[model samples]
Target: MSEVIWWKRGVIYQIYPRSYQDSNGDGIGDLNGIASRLDYLAGLGVDAIWISPFYPSPMADFGYDISDYCDVDPIFGTLQDFDRLVERAHGLGLKVILDFVPNHSSDQHPWFRESRSSRSNPKRDWYIWRDPAPDGGLPNNWVSNFGGSAWEFDASTGQYYYHAFLKEQPDLNWRNPEVREAMHEALRFWMRYGVDGFRVDVMWHLMKDEAFRDDPPNPGYREGWPDVQRVLQVNSADRPEVHEVVRGLRRVLDEFPDRVLIGEIYLPIERLVTYYGEDLSGAHLPFNFQLINAQWNAPTLASLIAEYEAALPPGGWPNWVLGNHDQKRIAARVGEEQARVAGMLLLTLRGTPTMYYGDELGIGAVTIPPDAVQDPWEKNEPGLGFNRDPQRTPMQWCPGEQAGFSSTKPWLPLSDHFREANVETLSKDPRSILSLYRALIAFRVQRPALRLGDLRLLPCGERVLAYERRLGDDRITVALNLSSEGQVVELSSRESHRVILSTYLDRQTEVATATVTLRPNEGIIIAA
Candidate 1:
């Protein structure tokens, strides 16, 4: 509404392909399956969609380890099916953003294969390859984020290759001009196909310290990794040269009008802001992940809200994410009753918001059986227990068998609670979280303040969290009772605000002494 791109001001729905909708009865969702659901997505008021990877892979990391950068996997669909999906999404007024995994590739990828061949091969230097230490140990003390050593021995080359994640996902050597150019060509292929943009995976790891120094010791331990120690010097995949690579990518995006580039950086706000590039044109939004890590409380939430607003680079866009394919769903994290409060916070924030699919239906994590778990992190990190299978289960659409997700059995079991949380069940209930999410999305669409506004935090009072979003002549203030009890916050004398939206079970019209009372875990948006 504030002269921003439509994709920037509206919500982005993230669909995990393997679990979203399966059409071929193969128990796994594909491109055609997602194309068939365009009407449902349109009805949900989403402006765009960001689908997870559907590229060819060995399914080692559930498609994150891409074997071919330009081709869709047989499990997902053909490239023609993908083009049809892109065409259909655009026809329905939905922009499509693809997941670009430039950090690493499946070990089976041709580039990796060539890189791992004889050291004399022209592509041998395309990936990060190094000699073992004098003691035949890993090149350094670096550990993979997934766990264990990041280096793997290549018997053919007699050298070790770096893989920041699973061994199958070998890290690319961006330091190689040829490698960077090849990846750039991959971008050209997608952009030429009319894809709107990309959600860069582990983008920070594009560049690494070339010297391969030993990682410093951890300051403290949680389960196994450090809590306060900075992994930048040793393990920070985001090297200084990453900016040059980003500039190259940004230039590619600049070639197309209205294209976007978002990066997933799991770092703190300070380090995250650097991804914006000093030229004010790098990653359009380095996802704000503080809320994902912050404790669910009034003080912590208030503090983080202020920190993120101030920490973002000047003129750079901000985006909020409550849940993703890799993390626990909000309902499972904060309880179903409080999930609406989290939704209100997300939708009412002053920037773009990305919604994980099934979140609008208040879906919770499935109780995964031990045999059905497929997350490599859980399999490798035994005692740490970092399983993400429950969060990536199939979307529940109805009360029928397989929850109407697929005619056949699904890759992961749907929760029994799907009988109550399915879209069909929530569509008929006006008081459901699904309804509340729609109302807020519509409310955001009609408001300029919530889209591109400057934020002002109101004074903290009586278990309430309040803030004002202002854009030009438009202004809206939001208040939330993050606690389990009611809270009363006084409003300005001349400010008679109308309740534009609320996530409470029912609306309360009573106002006592210019103070509005909020029910347990309630949130409201007021426009003056």
Candidate 2:
């Protein structure tokens, strides 16, 4: 057997807990609901699930504003319910990875409360607090990711508390050793509960510039973009100290067996790989969101894959994510038919693929009304059209009431295509996107060429992307047509090839000749 780690050879499924499935008619998904869906996830052949935050929170930024890192939110479940979730998920052979938000904690958290209580408090330095600038304005030009200034002035404390996100979520002082130890203890707490790993939220934003330097303007920023793009976050994000932080986190995670540390970073590929740290001591996989932001064209995606593959440090594993809770749905970003092609590219590429929950069904973003906007960013800037609620609706389990996600109305409205775009409805159709995903995942898992292989992008022209994944004697060739118009590519290989899986699920013709024909928006994996 190969010495590749399980995470290196497996795919991870992201489950946004609040919208995954609601069991108790509370209009919100809880731990029991997630537990109930274990078999469904297992049947999909995913090796692990990275659940978004379900910790006790004030819901200022939904679950991202964590009030208690150790306990489960009452709306989600209790500590016992979380225990049951981990146990059940592990029993089903699915590793459970929790979302670890070490960057910031809710202002309601006991640590922040004590830190902000009085300047003389024992934990006063646990969170970042600074005095006003010379003009008595704000500290500096640091921008909050949500919008507006990064500092929130506290009248009682006579200093400004920093928050990279919403004001309710204060930035934790990673510079302090005591704060680092406390956060490390949180990791230990979850590890003791049998959790497999963590997907650290905003891993690049852990350490900010100590001098509080003003962020410079983005020269390339265009009109009609989100306001947060107005300034380049030079001093606010992706500081060099974060790798040291990652090393410490890796040390804590090293105590466990077969565990993984995945970081959520949106940096350039060159800077992103450094999180792997010297000697691979940082994150095992700093999520590559390049696939998410890349244009849906062969040339664009081909260059992105090549650049990312070249950027990885020696012994550093690669991972891919097409969509996540914070971004637009892949189906909506690309078209519905092309989502399958995107899925193929995500899985067939030489990396561990993290599939967002509802993408397997080609689910599009639901329309969110002005009054029902849930994202704090949307509320902060209503004119920017940056609301994330449309992509966070409840999971469509069946065709029944509330799409069988809940007995009562769900917290968010169900998608309009819930009837046809559900697990039950698609389970019966062999050509459905869910079926395609199952087939692709099963095939990808069983093939060493797909799992533990070297990636080599072939020169197949601009409209077609062809790559080979070769492992010793085993080899798999993949061809993806980026356009709606049918195209053809010539493979250099003279050996015969058989179709393993196709995006359209009908192209099974063997490709023994140099020229290979393709259907519009088709993606196929061929056994070489």
| Winning candidate number (TM-score) | 2
Cα lDDT listed for each candidate: 0.85, 0.90
Best by the lDDT measure: 2
Query: Over all chains combined, what TM-score does candidate 2 have?
Result: 0.98
Q: Write the per-residue lDDT of candidate 1 for residues 1-528, one digit (tens) a residue.
A: 547787679899999999989999999999999999999999889998999999999989989999999999999999999999999999999999999999999999998887777898899888888899999888887777787788899887789998888999999888898988888889889989989999999888898887888777755544554222324344446678898898888888888988889999888888898998986768887877887878988788888888888887778788899999988999989888789999999998878999999899898867888888788888887545468987898888888889889999898888879899998899899989999988888878788788778888888564778889999999877888888988887775555667766786456343334677777888988766
Worst 10 residues of 1 by lDDT: 226-235
Measured with C-alpha atoms, the lDDT of residue 504 in candidate 1 is: 64
Q: What is the lDDT of residue 297 in candidate 2?
A: 86
Kindly provide the TM-score of model 1 when superposed on the true structure, using C-alpha atoms: 0.96
- lDDT measured at residue 241 in model 1 versus the true structure, 0 to 100: 84
TM-score of each: 0.96, 0.98
Model 1, C-alpha of 464: deviation from truth (Å) = 1.9
User: Model 2, range 284-398, lDDT digits (tens) per residue?
Assistant: 9999999888888888889989999999999888999999988899999989988999999889888889999999988997888776777889888887778888778899999
